[model samples]
Every structure is written in C-alpha cells, then in structure tokens.
Target chain A: MTRQELFEQIKIKQSFLCVGLDTDLNKIPSHLQKVADPIFEFNKQIIDQTADFAVAYKPNIAFYEALGPKGWESLQKTLDYIPKNIFSIADAKRGDIGNTSGLYAKAFFETMDFDSITVAPYMGIDSVSPFLSYENKWVILLALTSNEGSLDFQFSELKNGKPVYQEVLEKSSKWGNPDNMMYVVGATRGEKIGEVRKIVPEHFFLVPGVGAQGGSLEEVAKYGMNSRCGLLVNSSRGIIYAGKGTDFGTEARKEAKKLQGEMEVLLNQYCY
Target chain B: MTRQELFEQIKIKQSFLCVGLDTDLNKIPSHLQKVADPIFEFNKQIIDQTADFAVAYKPNIAFYEALGPKGWESLQKTLDYIPKNIFSIADAKRGDIGNTSGLYAKAFFETMDFDSITVAPYMGIDSVSPFLSYENKWVILLALTSNEGSLDFQFSELKNGKPVYQEVLEKSSKWGNPDNMMYVVGATRGEKIGEVRKIVPEHFFLVPGVGAQGGSLEEVAKYGMNSRCGLLVNSSRGIIYAGKGTDFGTEARKEAKKLQGEMEVLLNQYCY
Candidate 1:
C-alpha cells in the first residue's frame, strides 16, 4: 500500500494499531488443538475479534516456520483470511545478497502476497534494494529493535559520534522515500523514538514494544507521532494471549480495544 | 554435529568444501521439471553425484521459501536424502528477539533437524544466545559478507578504531566457543578474512564468494585457514549451475571435484 493509502486506513479506522500474530501452538487454547489447522483457526479468530481496532496484522514468520510446511499452509490461510483493507506484514526479518533477497521479495510479495516484509540491514544496500524495487511494497528495515539485544550493536558509536542505528537511518532512508519504506523503531525508549523521528521525520515507524514489553503508548505518541499518524504500535503477546479460555477471542478483543482507545486519544491530541 | 566431527569429515573427504544448495526451479534442467518433486529430485541427483567431493551442504532457505509450503516439503526431502556424515546448514540468515530467536533455533535445529543455521548479527547478544544454547548445533554469524552492501555498515569505524565487523568478531566470538559458534567471514577480501581470524583464531569461518563471486580460494586458504582446518568455503552458482543439461549432476560433480582437488592441496599445506 502507498503511504497515502496506509494513512487513509489509519484515518478511517481511527487506529494506527498493527496486531501481531506471533501465534504459537503451545500458547493457544488447548481445545482448538484438535482442529484441522489450529494455528489458522486461532489467527482467524484473532483477526475477527481485533480487526475493528487494527489497521494491519503483523505475523512474525518464525512462529509458523517452527511447525514446518504445515505451519506455512496455516500462515497462507491466515493471510488469505485477512480483510483486504487491512495491510499485511510478513515479519520475516530476511536479508541476503541481491539475487537471494530478490527471491525473498518474490516469496513475500508475489508468492504469498504480503504488503511488506521486515528486512535486517546488516547486508547493506543490495540486500535492501531488491525489496524496495517493488512498487507499493514496503521494506521495514530493522533500526532500533525492541529487544534487549538492541543495545549490543545498534548503539555502537561511529567515528562521527552517531550510533550505528542512526547511521542505518541516515543511509537507508535515502534508498527509498517515505512512500515505499518504513523503519522499525522500538517504543521502549521514547527519547530514542524522538531521536529516530528527527532522522527520518516523514517515514512511518512500526513501533513494537508497547504493551507486553513495558513501553508506554502515551510516551510513544508524545515523541513519535507525526501529521499522518505515522506509527503502528504493536502489542502481540498481551492481546493474543489475553485469555487462555474458550472465549479467548473476546478477551483478546478487550485488550485490543483498550489499546485502540488509548491510540484514539493520542491520535486526536498528539498527532498535530 | 560437533566441531571435531565436522573437522573429521573435512579430513576424511580431504576437502573443507561446502556445497551451497541454492536450488532454484528456474535454473534447474528441463528434464527435472516434469518430476513429482522436481526440486528434491534435482537435489537428490546432485547429492548422489557430489557427496564424495563435498563434506557439507548449505541450502539457502529463500530459494525454497519462494515456492511456499511445497518448497519446504522439497527442502525436507532434500535434507532427508543427504548422507548422515555430511554437515547440513540452513543458510536462513535468521535472528529476532530472545523468545522469537528461540523459536527460530527450534525451527532449524529440532523441528527441521539442521546441523547449523547462518544467523545475522544485527540483533546482537540475545538474538545469538538462544542458538548457542543448543548442543552440537552451530550458529554461523554473519561478520563480513561478500556482497557490495557489506561496505555499508560492516566497515563502519567504531569508537575503538576498529570496524563494526571486527567488533562483531570480538564480542560474538566469546558468546560461544569453537564447539558451537562460527563466523561467516567472506572470502571476497582475503585481508579481511585474516583480520577476522586474528579476532577469533579458533572458531570456524563459513567463507562464501569463492568462485562465482570472484574470491580466490588460494587467498581464502592463505588468510582464513587455522590449525584445525576452520573453514567451510561455499560456492553455489559455480557448482550447482555449472551444467544445465540432463547430465547436470555429472557436470556438477566435476566442478566439486575441481574445488575439492584444490582444497586437498591447501589442507595439506596451510592447515598445519
């Protein structure tokens, strides 16, 4: 989807939320395990319950991959089931040399048809350029990730006195404009979000550390929000694993609704 | 497989050559396309013809994944068909948060039963620690890659006056001993391989870019070889796409034999 198109979805839904389907079979309700495709069934219900509050659904590819080919079948089904208006993200975190990266672009963009795939920037421009070549498909490059490991390499000081992550933002942001690219800026450090925003002021930031990871929604909005409501705050574990019972979808919806509520208030106030 | 087991295979085969199974359906011979599982059939024939010359087979995951679940099924078949003595590598280049990285480790290690998986180091310690926890399995972290994009960040000068890739070598080498960890030091720059070897003298280095990407095998052996033959030089297109006819496997075997022949001499000389 184009940047304008994605912003329109945010405007129409009054939510910039991207529900993460990091669905693990071990974590889902036991009763659903007997189903033909439990992972798909779980994701279908999650989308059904949370679709109203979310503009996108981010499926971390590792979850389904753990189950092998059968898992990929379920993932394809889940992608097919999502509403057309809602953007889909394959959080695959894939990057390689140019030719191999092209095949990955084909995998996510042509074969399974995701709107975007998260890319690791370690391989440099060739690894990223293949994904960016596709029109309307986004390359969400890993900048400052939400995990504790982000501090290890992302913060390494360059000779110019900027951290490695900032250098990633500066160089990679030029590879594609705001329309075809986005950055995964962790929400854990609100000040860091502001710092990243200063680097790529117009690009959409997929902030992933909001609910379960102890990142505050208020602070993310305060630091990161732009005129386009340029943020997709994700809450995976807290919402998807909200209730372990049969009515888990209801509980998941409740959690998503709460986040949507907070986002609504932020969109009105902080998003000038 | 343990480090000793891999080294023993290298000695037994008289080669440290790693055959990269970057099997693309589009690139395979026309005769194989009509088979029930063409990808697996092609791989089976290739393994049969070249197993004697290659000690390790590294399948680049993106090629199979581009074809979707059917691709993965073909991959499983290919993995199953390989000889037990040979080392198997899923060149998946995968890494995420701690929990998600654990799932990836499970996918490549337990679920699929790969001996090792190439992991990107951009996410750092926690992203790598999960893979290191697995006994006998290896995490070949990307240090300096062969592509032009390697220049983007891997060469960034850090506060300590060393390049980022060197820092990756220094910090991550301690994460796991030679038993479970290896670094992907590209053969494109022989001096860089020597630089990487200086930091992690004992850990194995999975060096790509030998033939097809224009890295000299002699230079790689000269710079990267350690006392234990700590190198797995990979060549995908040079060996796999060497022939495009019905006799492709025979042609591939000839290419593998040529590399193995060179490696035999190198092993006898430099690997003291």
Candidate 2:
C-alpha cells in the first residue's frame, strides 16, 4: 500500500487502529482448541470480526515462530485471509548483516507479502535499507519501545545531549522517507511520543502500547497526530483476548468497535 | 551445552572454529540441486566435512526463513544432523517484549533444540531475560558487529564517555552470567574485538568476519583471546562455499582444516 492508500484506509474506516494478531495457541478459546489449525481459525475470526474497525493487522511474529513450521503455515494462512484493503504489518523485529538482511526482506516482503515489517535499527543502514527497496512496502524501525528494557540502551544519553532513541530517529529517518518508513513509538509514554514526533514528524508511528500497556489513546492522538493521521495505534492482548467463551470474536469486535469509535472522534478532533 | 562443555569441545578439537551454515539454495553446488532437499543436503555435507575441525555450528536463520516453511523444515533437519557434542547457535537475531521473547525462547531453544540463539539487545533487559531462562542454553547478544553499518549507532559516544556498545556490555553483563550469556563481537575490526573483550572479560565471543568478510584470524586470536580461549571464530563462505563443483565438501574440509591448523598454533602460543 502507498502512503496515500494507508491514509485513505484510515479515512474510509474512520480509524487508524492496527489490531495485533499476537496469537498464542494456549490463549485461544476452548472451543477452537480442537480445530485443525486453531491459531489460524482464531485469527481468521478475529480478522473477520474486527476488519470493519481496523485499518491494519500487526501479527507479532514471535507468537507464530514459537510453534515452528506449523506456526509459520498458520501465519501464512492468516495473512492470506486478511482483507486486502487492511494493511498487514509483520511485527518481526529482524535485522542482520547486509546480505543476510536482504534474505530477510525476501522472506517477509516477497515470500509472505507483508505491507510493512518492524525492523531493529541497531544494525544501522544496511540492516534496514534492504526492506525499503520494495515500493509501497514499509520498514517500521524501533524508536521508543514501550518495554521497560527500552531504557537500557535506547533511552541512554548521548554525548550530543540527545537520548539514543533521538540519535536513532535522526539518522534512520534520513535512510527512508515518510512514504516508505515508519517508527514504532510506544504509546506507554505519550509525552515521549510527542518528543519522537518532533524528531520525525512526517513518518507514520506504529504506536504499540495503546491498550494493554496503559497508553491513553487520547494522549497519543493529541501529541502524535499529523495532517496525514500519521499513527497506527496497536492493541494486542486487550482486544483479542477480550473474552474466554466461544463468543470471543463478538467480544473482540465490541472492544475494537469502542476503540474505532474513539479513533473516529480523535481523527476529526486532531488530524482534521 | 554448558560453558564447561563448550570449553571442553574447544580443547578437544584444538580449534574454536564455528562453521556458519548460511546455506543458500542458489549458491549450492549444481549437483545438490537434484536432491530431494538440497538445502539440507548441502548443509549436511558441510557439517560432515567441517565437524572434525569446528567446535560449533551457527545456522544463519534468514537464509532458511527466506524459503518459508520448507526452509524451516530444512533447518530442523540440519540441526538434527549436527554432531551431538558440537555447540549449536541459531543465528536468529530475535528479541521482542518479555512475553514475546519467551515465545522466541521456546522456538529456538525448546522446539528447535539450538544450544544458543543470537539476540539483538536494543529492546533492553526484558527482551533478553527470557532467553536466559533455559538452563544450559546461551544468549549470544550483539555487541560489535562486522558490517560497515556497525559504525552507525554502536560506536557512538555516550555522555558517560563510553561507546554505546560498552553501555550494552556493562548493563547486559549483569542480566545473565557468563555461563548463559555470550557476545557476538565481529572480527572485521580486529582491535574493536579487544575493546569488547576488556568490557566483557569472561563470556565467550562468537567472532564472525574472519574469512569472507576479511578479518585476520591471527588478529582476532591476539586481541580477543581469554583464559578459556574464549572465541568461536566463524568463517562462513570461506569454508562452506569453498568449492562450487561436485567435490565441494572435500574443498570445504580443506579450508576448515587450514583454519583449524592456524587455530591449533594460536592455542599453543596464546594459552596452553
């Protein structure tokens, strides 16, 4: 999808919600446990139910990777099942040496067909540039992640008086423009998102801490929104695991609808 | 494998050489192309020829992941084919939030049976801690990589007068003991390996860039060697793809033997 296409999806849906399909077999509803490919079934339903509200689906790759080849198959099926208009984000934080990274780009962008992939910036230019070569495909680099561990290295003070995340944003932003690049700015720190916004205002921010991580959606919109509605606020456990019964998809839809309704208000209030 | 076991393997072989199974289907000898599973067949040949000289095997995951599920199956077969005594390192630079990291741990350590997995430390402590939970398993964190891009963020000066890699070494060293933790200290810059060794004295360093990437084996041994001969010097293309003809395995063995010969001389000169 192009930058304009992504923004158009947001406008058409009245939301920039990116529902994370962090599917774990142990966490799925009991009724679905006996199915042939339970993980895919669960995700198929989640996509079916929440497609109306969500503009994107971010599948945390680790969840699928845990189950080995079978898990990868399930992931492929789920990707094929998602509505084409809804953007796909492979939340696989992968980076390596140049040649190796090119292979990874082949894996996610060519083989599996993700519109975007989350990449770690620690390896620098070559590790990330391979993913940017594909037109309409995106590279979501990690900036200020919501995890507590983000402080260990990413938030450290540099001699230049800027935090390491700022250094990451400043340099990495030059590697790819807003059209092909995005930043994973955690919503756990709304003000920090504002700080990141100031660093790279044009690139889309894949905000991951909006729901279960206690990031207020309102604060994210107020501080991080751009004229393009440059944010894809992600909610994983909060929406997918909304209920324990067979009616889990309905419960998930309810939670997604609530967020979408709020996002509609935020889009009108902030981006407009 | 435990630290003592790995060290014992190093002593037994008199070569801390690690064979990197960066098996690319397109690059394999044309004869293997007719095989049922050429990737695995190629890797099996490489491992068979190199095992006597190498103390460890590091399979670069991206090469396999690029092939999708079939590639994943080949990787599992390759792991199963490796000699039981040799250490296995999944060169999968994976790390995520805590819960997701745990799943990655399950993927590489539990499901796949790798003795260790390379993890990118940009996410901080939580992303790393999960991999350390498995007893007798290792987390080889990226400290100083060999690529030109390593200069991008890794070598930047921090406010405390230390480079970012040093900060990673200092903070991350406390998270896991030397027994369960190692560092990927690239050998592309020989002197940089020495600097990393000083910050992280006890833990083993999986040193890449010895051959195809152009770092001297002698320089790596001189600067990066420790009390336990604490270096697993990796040579990927130089050893594995040494010959493009039908006698590729024999040619690979010749290259590995040359490195092992040098390593034996280094072991006697530097340590015992």
Estimate the overall C-alpha local distance difference test score of candidate 2.
0.94
* lDDT tens digits by residue: candidate 1, B209-270: 99989999999999989999999999898998899999899999999999999999999999
Query: Relative to the true structure, how large is the alpha-carbon lDDT of every model?
Result: 0.93, 0.94
- Candidate 1: where are CA atoms >4 Å away? none
Q: Model 2 residue A173 lDDT? A: 90
lDDT of 2 by residue, A1-272 (tens): 99999999999999999999999888999999999999999999999999999999999999989899999999999999998899999999999989999999999998899999999999899999999999889999998999989989998999999999999999999998999999999988778988888989898999998878999999999999999999999999999999988999999999999999999999999998
Which residues of candidate 2, in runs, are more than 4 Å off?
none
lDDT of model 2 at residue B15? 95
Residue A73 in candidate 2, Cα distance off native in Å: 0.5
Task: Please write out the lDDT profile of model 2 over residues B32-121, one tens digit for every residue.
Answer: 999899999999999889999999999999999999999999999999999999999999999999999999999998889999999999
The candidate that wins on lDDT is 2
Question: Candidate 1 — which pairs collide?
Answer: none
Going through the candidates in order, the fraction of native interface contacts each one reproduces equals 0.86, 0.90
Q: How much is A39 displaced in model 2, in angstroms?
A: 0.7
TM-score of chain B of each: 0.99, 0.99
Distance from true location, Cα of B18 in model 1, Å: 0.4
